[model samples]
Target: MEQPLPKSWSIHTRPEVIAKYEILERVGSGAYSDVYRARRLSDNLIVALKEVHDYQSAFREIEALQMLHNCPNIVVLHEYFWREDEDAVLVLEFLRTDLAAVIRDAKKKEGGIRVGEIKRWMLQILCGVDACHRNMIVHRDLKPGNLLVSDDGVLKLADFGQARILMEPGFDGDDDNHQLPVEQNTGYQENVTPPLDVVADAHSLPDQGFNKQVVEDTNREEYLRQLVELKAKRHAVDETDKETNINDGYSSCLATGTISDIDDDPLKSSYSYDAEEGGDGRNGALTSCVGTRWFRAPELLYGSTDYGLEVDLWSLGCIFSELLTLEPLFPGISDIDQLGRIINVLGNLTEEVWPSCCKLPDYKTISFAKIENPTGLEACLPNKSADEISIVKRLVCYNPASRATTMELLNDKYFDEEPLPLPVTELHVPLTKNNHDEDSPGGWHDYDDMGSDSDFGDFGHFKVENTGSGFSMQFS
Candidate 1:
């Protein structure tokens, strides 16, 4: 009897992948994976082969890509396969360069990225971000390096290594009194099958199949439409379920053991600050010391775990500022230093200024040095147009609640300015020449190479481990 052929592409061995696709050269390497420009042997079609060694990061990126594959602004995941304990090979669409290279090249060759080009790139970035947010996923890491730019001038959001999926719709923090009803998809529960349009045939492999069903664009739109309707229904249900706080802004009697009595916790009375006496009685479930120090939000620095997409908006503001000036707005050495730099620019984070500042976990322990005069964004970007100034200000606003969402930025009047954003092809940003051989020079290879210290603050300690085929690096 002859040996049977592998039923699924995923079951194929490493030699099989090499036989089907010819790996030309290693184009890029990072803390977790190595990237190569390859050609499909059958048709000579070019593609990117990413050898992901970290199991957790690979799965996270795969899940994010599955949910966002149909988004045009997001990088397309053509196909992927895992072989036991071996690296998960992800075949992604070939993109010429990254935004970091484009910006760096512009600064070196031209004076700066043209205003029109900036608008175009920013709009596309926001589109990708909005799609992620709509699906209740947050791209926690948003920087120029991670954004890939194709030869056709199309900006695609790449690198979902640090993305997070929200369990609840939006960031309506865990509430006890107002028990919001879980909005279920029509005839679909957590264990139920996907919609008819999204579900594939019975013969199709359920998971980890190379020829898995690709999500169609129409299916994505329909899914989003249903999500919007579900949110509306949830809102209506929430309105009826909510119980009025008769105490209003004041603290309810602790002795009464009412609904607002902090669940009868005796520790509620121990705090020096009282909610009734003008304190922000917020108890957020935030963790400290996460994300890169430089682009970290003020709330994060203050130890506010109750943050949402607004933290990303704050980071974007920093990136937007850097694009214009070619330098980070607040390049702090440490977490405390980062908070100090923010205060130096946006003024003190006082109780009067930000009512919620007092509620942060670290507020009582940490004391930011008072700055005499806060040099605002206007002073920092003197040449920035009024429209640019306005948008950045809203993004890196002192209050996280006041920060604009990605969708809001898309509608801003800034895009309608004189000399409208250049058409995709008209944009004169840099593009890397595709290399397919060992003799080829590394063009834009360092575009997303773990970023520089200037961009991500100092890396404490990083280790590189060598696998049989490639190497994987881990940051401490």
Candidate 2:
């Protein structure tokens, strides 16, 4: 018999150890780990370093990450080693922000991730995924978050070596108990399941059920959260029992069919989603995140056990749908209702297609409504062109086999009709002409020649060149 490896393999040194790079502020974090900003002592330039307790989660994949450092689309790995002095550290390219940061900032304006923007994002992701696939790597947790951008406006695929970090269970929320094997949550969200005591403790607290209104049960966070937030603030409690008794004035008046106590709390209570309600909200199993839940594939919603890359495709489709129309394609409170949203729009799965699916772990319990007459493309995206509508339909199709591959989607007619160009390269310019002005750090050929001020939502320099035929980029 072989001796098993330890869980805490090796980690980066703490309190600013100067090996090759000087440690800086943290940029990203995992359930049990943290990533930081570090500067090269030699040049005083910044770079990102991922420090973990060990490499036990990666097994042999560490070699894979080290081998593919040549790929530009990937976050280049600088160096890796166990600080015999402390833990292990992974030095990498320091990107400015992830897609989440970019999208949140961009959404404030009308022009969110546009069709061209979506293409550019998807195209860059395809390049990354294809490269990973070529190397036989599967980024099981690929979301908008994993796609990152640097201050230089370059998009890079992060977490190629993420499997180690993704070793914990996430998506299949119900099955995982407090005590599960390290292998159980592999490929799922990291450390999603709270310890048994935590989950039990949360539910044990009297759930106030639903509010008096019809929307109470229909809207989970909107109603009770409203009351919970209001009650948490303003209405202070003198006694502990009063604080526990949630049937305070908010519900008291709501039940009387009177609009008196429905005083919307101006002091909005922010629900800490990361709060797990365990002993201290930490060390507890989590249900789902608002962001990752958006891209959950239909099979997972329907309770399918064995799934694969198609899950990522489903999320990609959903994200694309949201980007296309600026609305969530399948927004449901519960898994059953989520399936209904999917069925209503994309049509239910035919038995011939999802034949073996009924045998999944959650299948016996979930009885989804089979919508024979689902809505069509016109109904789904009212103003979208035939080509754009068709693309979304294919992407969100229920049959996993029938789902479009990333490559197939990259060549979609929609992107073709509204062609998106890659980041422009000055490779064609002469060596003399290629010289950028020293005044600008990016070495701009002519910074003053750039376009006028942009509208909030429009990021792409979308201007139709007035050639013989018009070339407008805006969607009607």
Q: Estimate, for each residue in 1-476, the C-alpha lDDT of model 2 and write its tens digit.
A: 99754434323424333556677665544432356777888888787766544333222224435444555566665655443333456566776555544454444457655555555555556656544543434454455455666554455666543321111222111111232233212122232331111001111112232112212343433433433442333122211222221211111001111111211111101111111211232222221211233455765544332334455567677666665665557654333445556667766555565654543333443343466777855686777767767767776776665666654554455544534433312001121212223464421122111111112123222233343443322211
| Candidate achieving the largest lDDT | 1
Q: For each candidate, C-alpha RMSD in Å?
A: 16.7, 22.0
lDDT of 2: 0.43
* Lowest-sum lDDT 10-residue window in model 2: 251-260
User: In model 2, which runs have C-alpha deviations exceeding 4 angstroms?
Assistant: 1-17, 54-64, 83-87, 161-291, 302-305, 331-337, 376-380, 422-476
Question: Mind giving the per-residue lDDT tens digits that candidate 1 earns over 96-197?
Answer: 666666665765655778776777777677767777766667666677666777777777778775555654432323222321122211111233222133
Instruction: Work out the TM-score per prediction.
Output: 0.65, 0.55
Tell me the lDDT of model 1 at 91: 77
What does the lDDT read for residue 236 in candidate 2? 29
Clashes per candidate, residues 3 or more apart or on different chains = 1, 14
